[model samples]
Target: MRRSRAALMAVVLATTASGTAAVTADAAPASATRATACPTGWGSLAEARAAATTVPVRDVGTGRHACFDRLVVHVPGASAASLGHRVRYVDRLRQDGSGRTIAVGGGAVLEIRVAAPGYRPETGAPTYPGRAGRPLPGVDLTGYSAFRNTRYAGSFEGETQFGLGVRARLPFRVLVLDGRVVVDVAHSWGAAR
Candidate 1:
C-alpha cells in the first residue's frame, strides 16, 4: 500500500510538469496573444446625453493603446458629474451652428460633443481656439492604428464639437472622468482572452 501511494504521487507530479511545459511551448508572443484578447464588450452605439455644464473645454488630445485608440476632451475645473457628452458615429461631420460639412480622413467618423463652451464663461474669451473645417492644431494622428484624422467641428452656444475619423465603425466607450471626457475605440471586436 505504501509503495502504491508513492507511485501515484510521482505520476501526478510528472503529469503536471509535462502539462506546464506543453503550454509554455505552445504559447504565442505577448502582443500576438493580446491582439486576439481584445475587449469587445463596448458596443458600437451612440452614447447620448442632453445635460449641459458651464465648464469650458480647454483642450483635446488623443493616444494609442495596445487594443484601442483614445480621445480625451479636457474640461478644466469640472467634475465627472458636472459634465455631459454625446458620442456617435456620423455619416459626415458638420460644424456646430453653421450646418457646414467638415472633411475627415478615416473610413468612419465619430462625432463628439461636449456640453460645455470653448469660451471663458466670465470674459467670453476663447479657451479652445479650434476652428471649423480645419485639423486641430498640434494634433497629429499620423501613425495611430485606429485614428486617421481629428477635426474641430465648432463651438456654438454652450457646446464644443470634434470629429474623430477612425479605421471603421468599431466598438467604443465613453468615460467622464474628473476634468475630462475619455472616448476609447477598440482596435477590433474580438473577445478578450
Candidate 2:
C-alpha cells in the first residue's frame, strides 16, 4: 500500500508540472508584451510654463519619427530652464500683437507661444525670418505623418507665436531642452507599436 501511494503522488506531481509548463509555453512573456505596448502617458492637453528670457528664437524646424512628428524651436544661448512656453490647441491661430487670424492647413491647429522674441531685443534684427500671416520659413511639411502645415503668427512684446497644423488632435508632449523647445505629436491614439 505504501508503494502504491508513493507512485500515485509522483504521477500527480508530474502531471501538474507538465500542465504548468504547457500554460507557460502558450502565453507570451511579460517583457515581450510590454515591448509592443505604446506609450500613452502624454495627453492632448495644453502645456504651459512662464519663464521670461532675453534669448531670441533662432529658427523653427521639423522632423519625422516612427511614432511621432517633432517640432523644434531653436533658441540660441538660452538654457532649458530659462525659456517659457504656452502650447495649446486653438480654433484659429492669431497674431501676437494684431490678433489677426492666421490660416493653417490641417484637421487641427496648435498654437505655440514662446516667451522670447523672434528678433534681437537691442537691434530689432530678425532672428527668425518668419513673418505674420505667412508660412513659416524653412519648414516644409512634405511627407510627414502628423504635421501638415506651419504658419507664423508674429512675435511681439517679448513673445513669439506660431501655428502648427496636424492631421488630427492626437496625443502630444512638450520638452524644454538646452537651446530647444521641442513638441512631439503622436501619429495615432492607438498603439504605436
Per-residue accuracy of model 2 over 98-118 as CA lDDT, tens digit each? 778889999999999999989
Candidate 2: what lDDT? 0.80
Candidate 1, which ten residues in sequence have the lowest lDDT sum?
Answer: 17-26
Task: Go through the candidates in order and give each one's C-alpha lDDT.
Answer: 0.78, 0.80
The parts of candidate 1 lying over 4 Å away from their true place are 1-36
Give model 2's clash tally. Answer: 0
Q: Judge candidate 1 against the unseen true structure and give its global Cα lDDT, from 0 to 1.
A: 0.78
Tens-place lDDT digits, model 1, residues 1-193: 4664465456446533322111121232344433334666798899976677888998887765546777888887888788899999999998878799999988899999999998987888999978788898777777677888999988888989999999999899998877888888887777653
lDDT of 1 at 70: 75
